[model samples]
Target: MKKTVKILSLFLIVLTVMISCKKDTDPADKDFFVGTYKGSVSYNKSGQSITSSDGRVTVSKIGETYSFYFGNNIPDITGVKFEKSGDNNYVSVGSGLTGITINASSLKMLVNKDGATWTADCSR
Candidate 1:
């Protein structure tokens, strides 16, 4: 009876530990943000600029890289990488002053690279 009690207690302790543990998930491993967002989007390079109020930005992921397909004839932003930020956000990784924050419901971008600027405020 003592041996049975010890075994049962050990099983209960292990089960409690497993139940309390949380799994850490990587955002890049899934396409949670891979969809089309619609709102305002703009792009500027040199002296030319393009803006649209009814714009769309499609998010796609291939491996660890992400691409942003913009509407309104704006050039697409490709080869972008992101790191997980906060609990449910992914922010772009780059050396420049690029800021692209993405979540399951929204996408915001103010990226400037290679003398070009892209701005977006969109939601799925």
Candidate 2:
């Protein structure tokens, strides 16, 4: 009984870690997302809240910006502007989720977390 209990605890711990640390992702077959996009977002670290609702994505040859909203009643952006960087990376600066993928299309993206980046996908 004790041995079984110990194994169960270990399994639970490993499962929790696996579920919590799921951030890395590759794009699906039909995703059109690439580049680093900056959205107007600020998290209240103290309270752990999302303060902003909308952010910008790069739109085109003229360097114009478009809005990609995370809140309700707002439309997802179309014709966003994006720029390529040194190696498989891009940046569109304006708001939150600043570093997005510009080379491929997918539901998930990467956001800068200090030195490393976090993966985030668009959910529709």
Candidate 3:
């Protein structure tokens, strides 16, 4: 059954190729961003805003979700899930009142709630 043997060989080759192929993955998907960053911070409320260059932030992952903790007790934002937004960049998904955009070297945050706002431009 030479024809049967040939068909089996082709099927095996196709299976090997399918098994060896890899999916496109981003570095941010591989825990490249779990760390601490420090830079500028700003907060505004009721027509008054305070700014400083001493901001600090820590990023942690539990399972597949990420959490952002800010210095000065700014209230940690939790349960944020990120999706790849660009080259080395990630943005939060389905988060209310808090939004973050981050790359390998920098992060920016904007939060608005109850007539108050907070923003940070930070870097590792």
By lDDT, rank the candidates, best first.
Answer: 1, 3, 2
Provide C-alpha RMSD values for all models, in order. Answer: 12.5, 14.6, 13.0
How many angstroms is residue 25 displaced in model 2 relative to the true structure, after the best TM-score fit? Answer: 21
Q: What is the descending TM-score order?
A: 1, 3, 2
Against the unseen true structure, what C-alpha lDDT does each candidate score?
Answer: 0.79, 0.40, 0.69
Off by over 4 Å in 2: 1-44, 50-63, 72-81, 85-90, 93-97, 107-119
Clashes of 1: 0
Candidate 3 lDDT by residue in tens digits, 18-124? 43322232326554335676888777777676677897877666556777787875666777777777677888777374478876677788877677777889876
Best by TM-score: 1
Candidate 2, 87: how far from true, in Å?
A: 10
Instruction: Give lDDT tens digits, candidate 2, residues 1-124.
Output: 9999999999997875454323332112113322333434333333344433344333222124433433422223433445556554445554454665543332234454433333334322
Better of 2 and 3 by TM-score: 3
RMSD of 2: 14.6
lDDT of 2 at 70: 37
- Model 3 scores worst on lDDT over the 10 consecutive residues at 18-27
As a whole number from 0 to 100, the lDDT of residue 96 in candidate 2 is: 51
